[model samples]
Target: MTGPSIVVAGGGSAGHIEPALAFADAVRRLRPDARVTALGTERGLDTTLIPARGYPLELIPPVPLPRKPSGDLLRLPGRVRGAVARVREVLSGVDADAVVGFGGYVALPAYLGARGRVPVVVHEANARAGLANKVGARFAEAVAVAVAGSGLPGEQVVGMPLRRSITGLDRVALRAEARAFFRLPPRGPVLLVFGGSQGARTLNTAVAEALPGLVRAGVAVLHAHGRGGQAAPPAPGYVPLPYIERMDLAYAAADAVLGRCGMTTVAEVTAVGLPAVYVPLPHGNGEQALNAAPVVAAGGGVLVEDAELTGERALAELLPLLTDPRRLAAMGAAARASGHADADERLARLVLDIVYRHNLESARGAVGSDDRATEVLRPDPRVWRQQ
Candidate 1:
């Protein structure tokens, strides 16, 4: 018998793509015979990263909804129609049993195309719901979120779907290897800092200015400044790189983190039990601050306004935390308590449950069953109950 086919959709930044990939990996692990296809746009990072990770990627035209009245807004209907048509073709070709979306331009079409035809599952990765996900949630059979109260219908907080490297990481056992990989001294406490994939000018500048103070306080630094960003000048206790390919190593090497509060960053740091100092982006929809709120409330991290995160301010706040082992250890434990390392598994199980229910519905329809018990769908109660 041909195994069930699943379509996983999302891609733009690493935030969306990584989770989609993690969920796909989980599905493959759980059901080796399952066929998984990734739906993404050519315009985003998915074009390169998806194929590189060994998944067959189906491309769809991007239908970006314009916030303001413009030419793009006028043409939006035609673009959406085309994208949805393309998604339908892909879904039919794969005989998709379920469509799982991680919320991106590509996901909106997948959700629309699969609605009423197959089971649809949506995963919202931010505290603030994006337009794509907001719409998808309305039609989705199962809606999952990384943060609570995300303004979506039937939202279940399943945490972020994390990469296997992160979920399976043994930070304590790999500490020596990670430190050696970065060429840092094995003895001192190392602080890891980075913005998102595109890098943050504010963080880069503040850390550059604060390096002397950190070095003096016996703290070593591993800085991934993002692609094309200027590296800090060499110092005895500082290591600077434009990008970090092996983030698991970086996390393993660090005692604490100083970074933005993007959903993926917050999830990864807390999963590994690393204390953090989060500086939410000053601009945008203010979701970053909301993303870091639960962790901060849990005493896993501290949140500072972007404006207040100066070199001196960072040193003043971080120095005390770095010097105090007991406080750092307490914060680490709190972080781990707040994080869900099994998020990928939970999401994968949700997908499978949707597929199972879809198959059952199909079977019921074929038999013309009138029994309410046969019609009533119950997913794995344990999986659905994950908060």
Candidate 2:
């Protein structure tokens, strides 16, 4: 028999969608014939991401909800009904033996609409459990988490799945390739700055304020100011891109990273073995800082609180490392050591195990209804072995 088909439903941003793609790729690696579909709203990054990855894409209607019992609460029931309908419609054509939700607004309806006989798994990518993942977790056969602190049931610490391009980068080749890609100086330290996708205004402001001194110290900088951030005019030693297209090259080129502590960013940095100065988003319950704590605790990076990330303090934290080559190398090695390279493979197997088990249970249930209660269907051993 052919390998079971699976659906990955999540998006809205690259952080959630990219990891889903990584898991899908991992599944393809193990079961070449397995069919994988990505279901997300057409409005999200999925429109570009799914097609670019050459996966079947399905779009569903958006469900708007309230944060604090606003007037939108009155329309809650109708919105949910519409969302469920949209999810069912999107899922109807595909024979998904399993469904995996990487937490986002899109995940909630995907899980609710697909949950029953088909096994479902939810992967929460934040330190704090997101609402979509939290709701999906209750019905999920298993839950995967990027951070250990995510408070969700059936939680397994899988780390974040990184793309093969980034994960497979060879260190020696990366060093040379990265330098060529960024056009950096032969042997000077390079600082990479980013703030997830939307760009942290606070982080950008601080980096811009501190740039002159960093330049004076002979440190090269490759900055991703974000799509909507302060546009500082170009300087001799600094290169600012609104967005970075080639992350592997950027990671390879950096001696150190200074950025927000989104779970995805932290995982990518750890995977690449690049040390960072993390400035976690101050609002939203400090989840970003919580995500970065493990790396900081492991001595792989430094965490700078948003309130404390002034120009002088940022300089103070970054300057010593730029000047000390040995310390930077040690930090980079430590960061890489903290990453889990096998995360995508293990997560893919776990998802399949749940699906196979659910299928067997369903088969047995059908047998009982047909007055063959004593008979039970056993899945082929190959499924278990593959899982």
Candidate 3:
């Protein structure tokens, strides 16, 4: 209670965990003394990721929302109570000054627990808001989004919070080295392909079928086919990776990218100023398409439906763009123009501001006076770059 203790709540998929970790990273930088604990559930990847990031992990019961009317819906009330109560215990144990949440199942409980006790800050990383985020926004003291039109409560679009490796990547200077790391030639346009830990079947199949032709067209490739994906003999000018630990190097080696249009992907691609061909997941609420809308509108990237991303289509749509220097440069510039490379720091400042302000008011016996006039401070830019 004496020092600011921040809790970042986002669990399950990499989409949720990555941003939470990114925010935690920035918090550690800006508030070195602040204790940052990751709020997660035993059901999610946080069991491994949180501790791996050097943050204490606290598990809570998950209350996943049913998509339709069902028996699960009937149990919603009881589940919410259990989850919120556990979150309350976690908050109290950590002396939480604020709950900074990237919306997911865990975020809802974190929001409910922090309602009157500590200020809640919600961050929506997609163009369309999810159920937990929508609910969290109603009570959040501050709201941040990756892009406009999130349909969440806030107009503060700070873009996605990303690690400094991406924000500070000097692609031009690292190109030769990145190429060398991938065992690629220093010249020719490179297409860096990745589709997450579980390979996107569409990307894997299409790229494989198009590989020989892509090489014939004078394009080199560094493709991560996900762990346990299919394998084959290494072709000339093509490098296949089972996993990519150094994305900074990958981005440096890429002239253009081929991947799905998720918020994290879009943010990282744009933050590093690379042209991408986004293939949105055909299912879900179509938020994937919306996530890529701004970049497509800016002529920074191309959006293709997953069902339509065949080998021929990829060649027709991607070949010219990847090969053309002028077009690639312009698209990269446009992508960078739409990026918020400093979002991690910006949101960290916002979180610390809300926490410190609330603490000051409590000290002055002015708790809950609705005074959020805290000025956001920026850390020296050199600090992040040096890191």
Off by over 4 Å in 2: 89-92, 231-236, 361-380, 383-387
TM-score of each: 0.94, 0.91, 0.91
Rank ordering of all candidates by TM-score, starting from the highest: 1, 2, 3
Candidate achieving higher TM-score, 1 or 3: 1
Best by TM-score: 1
lDDT of candidate 1 over 1-387, digit per residue (tens): 455688998877778899999988888877767799999887869889999988999999998867779999899889999999999999999999999999878888888999888889999999999888999999899999999989999999999999889988999999999999999889888999999776888888889889999988899999989896776778887999888999999999999999999999999999999999999999999999999999999999999999988889889878888889999999999998899888988988888877766676666777677354244433332332233
Clashing pairs in 3: none
Q: Better model by TM-score, 1 or 2?
A: 1
Identify the candidate with maximal lDDT: 1
Residue 275, candidate 1: C-alpha displacement in angstroms: 0.2
Q: Rate the local accuracy (lDDT) of all candidates.
A: 0.88, 0.82, 0.86
lDDT score, residue 39, model 2? 82
Could you tell me the TM-score of candidate 3?
A: 0.91
True-structure RMSD, every candidate: 3.2, 3.1, 4.2
Q: Please give, for residues 93-200, the per-residue lDDT of candidate 2 as tens digits.
A: 777888899977778778888877477899988889877888889988898988797889968998888888877877567787787777877568899999866678
Error of 3 at 88 (Å): 1.1
Off by over 4 Å in 1: 368-387
Give the per-residue lDDT digits (tens) of candidate 3, residues 1-387.
Answer: 234689999888778998888888988887676799888888868798888989999989988888799999999889999999999999999988899989888888889988988899999999888888888899899999998998886558888999888999999999999999999889999998998876688898889888877989899988888896764347888898888999999999999999988899999999999999999988889988998899999989999899999889889878999879999999999999988899998888888877766655664463333332221212332232233
